[model samples]
Target: MDDYTWRIKMHQRRRRVRRERFAVLMLVVLSICGAIWYFGLYARTPEYAAKKLEQALEEKDIETFRKYAALELVLSDAYDDLTVDLFHNDTSLTPQAKSLFEKFYVLIKPQLVGATEDVICKRVSGGMWVMPEGGDMLKGRQLGIDYEEFLERSLLRSTRIKSLGEVTKENGSASIILEVLEENSHTPFTLELGMEKNDEGDWQVVSIKNYRTYLETVSPRIHQEVTEYVQATAGIVAKYNEILQSKQWDATYMSYSATGQLTKEQRTGLANYLENSVIPIVKKRQEELNQIPVPRGAMYLSNLRKESTDLSIRVWQHYVHGLRDDNIAEFNTAESLLKQMLATEQRIEDIIHRAAVSKAIPNMP
Candidate 1:
């Protein structure tokens, strides 16, 4: 009986060992299959993906563009700097100030984003905006003879992919650098695409390198016009500074009689005189400087520069409004400072708007 029982126990241990070995073998096989799927069948070649994106853009296939295209949040100190004026530098904002800032951001953000995205699409599409024979580019509209072919004929083409390098892949991410030669140049620029695998393990485009490009397709005349507008704006700003520094507004506002003499009553409240009479002079100054035409669509850079100039002027307008509101609370403490600020403010206001002081410039139609 002891011998029989011992043989039974030995047989059970042998069966257990065989099961453990089988489990180990299954794990190894499964791991090899996983590696193959992650690398081969699921993941796409980076070069192929890059070429696909290029073709999608050139062909204006909105369907394909939407498939591979994704927006990436590339965080940087530069973005922080963009918001510095709103909060970082001025941490002492009152609730009202913060609310106004938020409202301003809400107002301007969509305009900035829409305009900038249009610019980006134009750039990525090789600056091919219009269709053949002055037709509107009806993207993905089954236009005859392809958008790519249309770009090949336009004078505004910005890129032709020379060659795509072998995709570099690691840790479930891939990237490729493509050499692009333009129609007018022998030298080439490299376009790098950052790609990552999605849940289904397909490689997708994450970004278009540094978004801004050096490849704008503008006419020489437009370039010259933009240059001239920038220079003229600088000159106008200089003249504004001169007028403010000369204290011409102060002199003109002090005591305007048939003659230039002031009695004791006339000199009593400088603030009162300014509050009453200085606005007309401001109006006249605004009229004189509002002669600048609306260079809205002249050139992209010029339009942006014009917008920037107006932005500075708007800040000054806000400052003056704040000062006036503060004087109501503080019993007019900074009255002299407010007066001088408004004086300087009006000059730039007149100059930048090229229109009117205290008027809103609609960023959109």
Candidate 2:
């Protein structure tokens, strides 16, 4: 080969060598990724199984959970936590997990499998509730058992789980989403859970991440009892307004429910609740409203009515009768009366807010 030919041949050889190096590099990267996806993602350690078991526990899905848990974990913790719940007569658990599970079963299990399950199912298909671990989220550390009460109240409260789909797993750690339907607000709230396994091979929930759960209210057809309440409450409030204006104390007292009627025993409690709870707060809010000049325009009556309707629906949700019934007749009566009172409360609050806004703008019709 001549000098030119030699240069050209050398260039070609260099290009081929570079290409081969690049190919090898790509192969290495792909192999590493495949390993992570397989062992880290698909492989199940006792920890991963335990986490799934915990999710099953929160869901109260005993049958499905039974399959996910290890035999030892099931015999030890699972048995106690699921079978002997207050509502469940499974009788297959030790008294401790069973007794503790009772509180959870009474409060949350129904939402997972019973009638409430339908409501949740409609919200998220293949619906599963992922609860956030409670504590400092940065390190994903859990609170100690001694602080159980504080953990329960504080961890569950003030959490901000927006959607259940945000949960994912990394390494051996699983990120969970805690979904809860608030009774008073009638809204679905979510929070993130960070969990890991302890030395004992038992899974411990660590912390709640991004704790920013906010109010999410929805509008739908309410129960019939709630509708009845809206009408009855409006009527009762109209009557009460007339009674207050006409100074019919006796008749007003008679119209009040037993709790509100100021029975000899209840008078003190009512006075304390009204004085300490309602008036001071409303008056303070009114004072604040007085300082801030009302806006030039008022929210339309239709808009106000819509807001009131939504609020009424939310308040009335508490009257929902669940799976257990001591007596159907009693449930119906209590539910009806409760819904009516809630509707009245909604209407009264609506009127109060509108009145305040109206007074802010004297020309508002």
Which one wins on TM-score?
Answer: 1
What is the C-alpha lDDT profile of model 1 across 131-186, one tens digit per residue? 32334342222332223222221222444677777667778777777667643323
lDDT of 2 at 134: 32
lDDT minimum window of 10 residues, candidate 2: 215-224
What TM-score against the true fold does each predicted structure earn? 0.32, 0.27
What is the lDDT of every predicted structure here?
0.47, 0.40
Off by over 4 Å in 1: 1-43, 72-166, 178-191, 208-365
- Backbone clash count for every predicted candidate, in the order shown: 0, 12
Q: What is the lDDT, from 0 to 100, of the residue 47 in candidate 2? A: 49
Question: Residue 112 error for model 1, in Å?
Answer: 6.8
